[model samples]
Target: MDKAQIKIYGLLENYLEYCKTNGFTDFEIWCEDNIDSANEKGLVQDIYREVNHIADKLFD
Candidate 1:
């Protein structure tokens, strides 16, 4: 994985933890709410794709 991919993966890891800790059952909803935070952290191109990819790997 490239640096961006790795960073996104790490972010998704944290997001998963956040969801588990906070009782959030919907990944899409969490993404909708927190995508801007990812953007603010410098995610741009392929953000959704990358996030989905990481999420699938972790949650599937």
Candidate 2:
């Protein structure tokens, strides 16, 4: 992956950790805001969906 892709992935990984440690619902607003700011719409949606899923399992 390119630097930007790698960086975004890394950041998303960290975000996942944060969501996992906390709660998915707790991070909903942040996730929405991030998805808005993310320049890559496709990637953002993908990450948002994946993270939300992971967070949901943790929350459950």
Candidate 1 lDDT by residue in tens digits, 1-60: 766566556766777787556644444445454444554345534455555566566555
lDDT by residue for model 2 (1-60), tens:
855466567667777777667756533346444443445445665566666677788765
lDDT for every model? 0.56, 0.61
TM-score of each: 0.43, 0.55
**Which residue runs does candidate 1 get wrong by more than 4 Å?**
25-60
lDDT of 1 at 54: 60
Give me the displacement of residue 2 in model 1, in angstroms. 0.3
Which pairs clash (backbone N, Cα, C closer than 3 Å) in model 2?
A: none
Which prediction has the highest lDDT against the true structure?
2
TM-score of 1: 0.43
